[model samples]
Target: MATDPVCKMNVEPAKAAAKVDYNGQLYYFCSESCHKAFTEAPQKYAGAAPPPHSSHQHGHR
Candidate 1:
């Protein structure tokens, strides 16, 4: 899964609705809107680090 730089949504690379190559890296998007938004002003929405994982864990009986 790839993180959409614009919306931070998890995107499946093989099934991504849109994708773009910026600065020699490929970015995936969940929708066309996100793709357009990214392409328009990449600097505004690029290089967003993926959301961090939760440190807490739940135990079930």
Candidate 2:
């Protein structure tokens, strides 16, 4: 599982609605809206550190 940087939701990479690569790292999003927002200005959501990359972490629904 991965953390959706824009909305902070737990998402499975294999089941993610969207995915983006930034600075050699992979990011997952729960919805297209969040993906769009992140693409428009990733810095706004990513902040100082990128979300942790995980395979099966739990997150808010």
Q: Highest lDDT among the candidates is held by which one?
A: 2
**lDDT by residue for model 2 over 23-59, one digit each (tens)?**
7778899999999999999888777454565424666
Question: Which runs in model 2 stand beyond 4 Å of their true positions?
Answer: 48-61
**Cα misplacement distance, residue 14 of candidate 1 (Å):** 0.3
**What's model 2's overall lDDT?**
0.85
lDDT of 2 at 2: 89
Model 1 Cα lDDT, one tens digit per residue, 16-55: 9999988767999999999999999997776455224322
For each candidate in turn, the TM-score is: 0.75, 0.75
Which portions of model 1 show Cα errors greater than 4 Å? 50-61
TM-score of 2: 0.75
